[model samples]
Target: MQITHLGHSCLLVEVAGRRVLLDPGTFSSFEGVEGLDAVLITHQHFDHLDPDRVPVLLERNPHAVVHADPESVRLLADKDIPARPTVDGEPFSFGDLTVTPVGAQHAVITEYVPRIANVGLVLRAPGEPSLFHPGDALDAEVPAVDLLAVPVSAPWCAVKETVEFVRRIAPTAVVPIHDGLLTDPGRGVYLHHITEFGRDGGVPVRDLRGAGAVTV
Candidate 1:
């Protein structure tokens, strides 16, 4: 499988002769992406689901089916974009790829902040390594995967939590996400720590901050 880090949590994943775009939000641009088989969204947050760009995506990839949580589906319906509601543990097929939704809610930001629906996705294709993208949450009990998209920076997460989460998942490799807010120096600091710490645990973490495609 090959994954392109568009920016932040958005990724363009290609596997099993199909292309799937995950979370093409405000932090990333999907201007030229086309011929996608599926689009997976974890939540309704603006950073993960931009109102302006999603419609453009639908227009470009008219055949691509959208999968998201119930709340997101309702909002997409208002824009006349049909979306399937993702149910935890139920696997949905997109050509040769199988996507299973995990987790039920977004990570809590604070006591006063109301939690929203979130779903971490586990994707697998024939003869390809399994990959997991955990949206904005870190509490999901996901199955073991070859590649894990880790949240390196966020309002509800810290460096310590990020390290612990990577340890719990124990993936073969990690691609950092949810780091749009970090400056270059800040990103470098987190990347250095994660890479050094992950190395000790037999996991190689790649910093895809401003790069192109990387095979997994």
Candidate 2:
């Protein structure tokens, strides 16, 4: 399995001849996101949804499928995409992968109602360890994996929270996300904080700089 991090919460996982993109933000349409076989959206948010990009994606890959929670389905249906709604505890297959939906909470907004169908994904890759992407929540019991793409930012995610979260999961390798895409690009410094968080928890952290790509 090969994984490419397209910044923010987006990732491109390629196995066999199929490619699955997870939580693709505007980055997908930017470049390197064409020909996707499937997409797994964690929730409905401007950055995660990127409605402007879907139509182009559909045009490029007519057989591509998009999977999301109910709220996301309703939101996409208005846009005329063939989106499949999913719920927690439900499992589905895409190529050689078996994906399981895990519960999560939406990122807190000051005045907006949180999208309640937020989810984390547990993708079991053929001949490789299962990988987990914790959407907007950090309270989940991390599943075992060869690689764990854990979120390390957002106002609610502090150093202590990351420390505790990593300790609980104890994945072989940990890569940080959801931090570098801040409104103020200077906040990229916060990624440095992840090292201490992992040090305190005794979990090894992988560097997320550049376009993160690794063969698992």
Candidate 3:
């Protein structure tokens, strides 16, 4: 399995000849990409939704299966894409991949009201270990994850919290995300937290913003 970081919390995972895009918004770098087998939306936030990109994506890959929260599913129904609505704890299969939705909460406190449901995806590929993508918050419990994508900032998260979350999950490796809001020269906060957490614990941390790759 291969994982490519496409900015922010967005990531493209390729496994078993299938491509799975996760939260391709909020500084997403997957602008002109094509041939996606599945798209997973964690929540309905604009940074996560990226309506402008979804339409084009659908046009490029009409057969691409989109799995998202109920609200996101409703929003994408108007498009020609083959979208599927998923609920927490629901497990479904797509080719050699099996996805299990896990509940999560967006930490933002706005009056707009998060009418959308938030969730994390647990993807298990044939012969490969299970991978977890905990979208926004780190308030969920997972068992035996080989690879874990964790958010390190925004609304509610710090270096301490990140380290604790990683230790609790006990994943084989951890990837830091949710830091694209900062400019190129303004990534001190996120970097500091990530570095501190890495130092505090023995867990290996990958810098998703860079060109490095993570293979599971």
Candidate 4:
């Protein structure tokens, strides 16, 4: 499987002769991207689902299907995007890839803020390593995967919690995500700590900040 990080949590994943784009939001660009088989959205947050860019993405990839949680499906329906609502444990297939939706809610931001629906995805294809992308939540019940997109930084998470989450998942390798708010230096520090802690746990973490296409 080939995964290209398109900034923040956006990933263009190519496997089993199919292309899947995950979370093309305000922090990332889906410009010039086409011929996608599926677009998997985790939630309704602007940082994870851009209202303006999604229409353009649909224009570019006319055949691609949009899949999201129920709340996001409602929002997309209002925009006339027509997204299919996904439930936990339910699997959706696109060509040779089978994507199973997991989790039901986003992480809590604060006591006053109401939590929204979020669904992480577990992707599997023939002859390729399994992968999981856990949207904005850290406590989702993710299955074992070869490649895990770890949320290294977020409003609901800290460096220690991120490290512990990685240890709990224990994927073969980890790719940092949800880091759009970090500056270069702050990103450096977080990456260093994550790498160190991941090393201690016998897991290698790959930093995809500027580099692209890490194969698994």
Candidate 5:
């Protein structure tokens, strides 16, 4: 399988000769991205699902299946974009690729902010390494995966929590997501600690900011 970090939390995952784009949101520009077999969203947050722009993306990839959390499904439905709900533990198949939705709630930002439905994704296929993208939560009991996309920076989490989340999963390698708002130096600081403290302090951390398509 191959993955391309298309800015922030948006990822273009290509496997089994199919392309799946995750979270083409306000933070990421997926204007030219096409030929998607599916468009998977974790939540309705603007950074995860840009309702205004998603319609355009769907229009571009007319054949792409849309799957999102229930709340996000409603939001998309309002825009006349049909989407399937990504129920927890339920799996969706696209030929040889299998995408499973896991987790149910977004992390608690604060007592004042009401939590929303958020579901992460676990993707796998024959002859390819399994992968997990944990949306906005660090507390999900995710299954084993070869690659784990960690939300290294966000308003609801700290660098310490990011490192611990990686250790808890203990994947073969780690990648950064939800870092759309960080400055270069700030991003450096978060990754510095994540790399130094995650998984025996030696887990391979891949920051796919400028690098092109990465084979995993």
Candidate 6:
């Protein structure tokens, strides 16, 4: 499988002969990104799914089907765009690629803010290692997978929990996500800790911020 980070949480993943794009939000850049077989949005947050930009992307790729969380689907319906609700334990198939959505709740930020639905994804294809992308939550139940996209920095995220999550999951490799809020220097500092954790846990940390299309 091959994955490319287009900034923030957006990932252009190629696996099982299919090209799937995940979370093209406000922080991510997908101006000319095309040939998408499918688009997976974990929630309705603008950072994860841009309200204005996503429709343009779907318009560009008319055949691409969008599978988003239930609320996100409803919001898209208001825009006259059709979308399927991706829920917990539900599996969606994209030819050879099978995506299983898990976890239905986003991480809590504060008591004042309402919690939203966030679905983590597990992608598996024949003879390929399963890839897990936990949208905006860390407490999601994740099974063993070869590659895991771990959120490194966010308002609700802390360095301790970040390292603990990685240490607990202990996936073969990890890719950093949800880091658009930080500057280059700040992002480097966060990645440094996560990288060291991955190294100590015997897991390789793969940061694909500037690097293009990496096979995992």
Question: Which one wins on lDDT?
Answer: 5
Q: Distance from true position, residue 89, model 2, in Å?
A: 1.3
Cα deviation of 176, candidate 4, in Å: 1.0
Better of 5 and 6 by TM-score: 5
**lDDT (tens digit, per residue) of candidate 1 on 1-216:** 888899999999999999999998899978899999999999999889997789888889998999998889999999888999998898899779999999989998999999999999999988899999999888988877988999889998888888888888889989889989999899989887787776574568766766787887
After superposition on all C-alphas, the RMSD of every candidate to the true structure, in Å, is: 1.2, 2.8, 2.6, 1.2, 0.9, 1.3
The TM-scores of all predictions, comma-separated, are 0.96, 0.85, 0.86, 0.96, 0.98, 0.96
Q: Rank all candidate structures by their lDDT, best first, as comma-separated numbers.
A: 5, 6, 1, 4, 3, 2
Pick out the ten consecutive residues of candidate 2 with the lowest summed lDDT.
183-192
* Residues 80-171 of candidate 3: C-alpha lDDT, one tens digit per residue: 54468877888988788998988756654565755346788899977986789988767777768888887766655666777677778888
By TM-score, who's the top model here?
5
* Residues 84-176 of candidate 2: C-alpha lDDT, one tens digit per residue: 876677889876778888775664544465446688788886677567887777766545776678776766566667666766777777776
- Over the full model, what C-alpha lDDT does candidate 6 score relative to the true structure? 0.89
**Off by more than 4 A, model 6:** 198-202
Query: Who is ahead in TM-score, 2 or 6?
Result: 6
lDDT of 3: 0.76
Output the better candidate (5/6) by lDDT: 5
Each prediction's whole-model lDDT (CA): 0.88, 0.72, 0.76, 0.88, 0.90, 0.89
For candidate 5, write residues 174-205 as lDDT tens digits.
88888989999999898888888897748898
Deviation (Å) of 195 in candidate 1: 1.8
**Candidate 4 at 2: error in angstroms?**
1.2
Q: Is candidate 2 or candidate 5 better by TM-score?
A: 5
lDDT of 5 at 38: 97
